[model samples]
Target: MAARHSRKLLRPLLYTSAAAAAGAGVLYISYRPRNIPGLEAPAVPPPGYREGKLVPPSFPSIKSRLEQIQDLKRSNDEEEYDLLIIGGGATGAGIALDAATRGLKVAVVERDDFSSGTSSKSTKLVHGGVRYLEKAVWELDYNQ
Candidate 1:
């Protein structure tokens, strides 16, 4: 008699638990950050790291400031140029190329060599955030 009553309660409890689990799975898949007003754009490559087949970033120890940047006029034989580029990083390089192509005299200066700053320290993969693998691992463990 007691066993029969226990079974009756168990059936409904199991059904409720299964429904809740299914609902959670559905929510996890469908939900993602949509339009959060005033939220800043995510980082180019996120903080952690990544592994791939590409030339890794290299850094110098104590940069004693390049002469070209410190004394622009001294480095240059000409008085002035049409465009004076600030850094020799990727963006700056692109700017210089564009200006030069347009028949404008251009000069680019960098405290260090090309991409020597943070840009130089990139891990090859262009369109990915750094913590991608970590996120994947987390998602795998995080059962909805």
Candidate 2:
């Protein structure tokens, strides 16, 4: 009877150990750094970021909303943007960044605050659309 009781406890312990091992394996797989193609070198820390903490940069006096709007208008009238993004959400912001990085003048105009639109309601998963994949297969379009 004692042996059977011990066996029951051992079975649960064995199951718990297996679960812990599985969880650890998943964590290792998820967090393990892999070498990316174009990012061979280590990333440089952003400005105002130092030693595991962010050192906020000193800025000029904060402008009022009206002043900011006037400044934006002046800049918009003076400079021509190669790409003008309608939204300031994730997709628009990403496009603007890419364009600016490629030496293009990019302007993003948002009606609401950045990411206040559809970008805010994200699952946080980077995934390709299955519909697009299906379409690609059907049309034999490798670029899709």
Cα RMSD (Å) per model?
A: 17.9, 15.7
Candidate 2 lDDT, 1-144, residue by residue in tens = 999999999999999999999999999999987854445432443358679888865555766656756766787555866887897777777667667666687767778876676744553322345457777999999999
**lDDT against true structure, model 1:** 0.66
Q: Number of backbone collisions per candidate, in order?
A: 1, 0
Model 1, 1-144: lDDT tens per residue?
A: 999999999999999999999999999878965655436543233344457545444443543456544665564556668898887776777668767766577877777767766554544332243256556677774432
Error of 2 at 79 (Å): 2.0
Best by lDDT: 2
Q: What C-alpha lDDT do the candidate models reach, one value each?
A: 0.66, 0.71
Best by TM-score: 2
Q: What's the CA error at residue 2 for candidate 1, in Å?
A: 99
Candidate 1, residue 115: the lDDT equals 76
Clashes of 2: 0
Worst 10 residues of 1 by lDDT: 122-131
